[model samples]
Target: MRLILPILFLTILSIKAFSREVASDSLANIARNAMFTDAYIQIEGKLHSKKLKVEVNLGDTPEQTKAGKEYSEKLTGKSHMLLS
Candidate 1:
């Protein structure tokens, strides 16, 4: 019947929307868990107004610094300062 089709369509649409929301929430949780507080990026200067500088201090350890340098270069497109 027409009513049955409409109800089924609405149900399917709602289910799809719910799934998307759940997927987004899970992705957010994953990103939150993966946040690196020790490794960060610092922009020391203004952009277009002054010499824009990017400072990255990955960590105190050498290994951490090395990884931070690589990540910084990748993120900033090889334009910035990486302080160990």
Candidate 2:
């Protein structure tokens, strides 16, 4: 009877552990999908009778210019770029 209790306890513990691992894996997958989501930046302007338009898919949301320059540099490896 003592052996049976220990075995059952261990079994239940292992099941809980497995369930937690599965939940962690699912959450990780959701985070990975969100990380890979697509974002964009579009610019349209006129320069002295010339019209210019630019569009780019950045794969992430744009931060404000003050906080975003670093992120843009990290994404493109370029300095002094505007993402918004």
Instruction: Return the top candidate by TM-score.
Output: 1
Worst 10 residues of 1 by lDDT: 75-84
TM-score of each: 0.34, 0.24
Task: List the global CA lDDT of all models.
Answer: 0.68, 0.55
Q: Positional deviation of 59 in candidate 2, in angstroms?
A: 28
Model 2 clashing-pair count: 0
Backbone clashes in each candidate structure, one number apiece? 0, 0
Taking every candidate in turn, the Cα RMSD to the unseen true structure, in Å, is 8.3, 11.2
The residue-by-residue lDDT of candidate 1 on 1-84, one tens digit each, is: 979999999999989888833578888889888956565677655544335445578788888888878765665533344444
Q: Which lDDT value does model 2 have at 41?
A: 56
Model 1 pairs whose backbones collide: none
Model 2 is weakest, by summed lDDT over 10 consecutive residues, at 72-81
Q: How would you encode candidate 2's per-residue C-alpha lDDT over 4-84 as one tens digit per residue?
A: 999999999989888833578888888888844354555455433234344555444345443445443444423333444
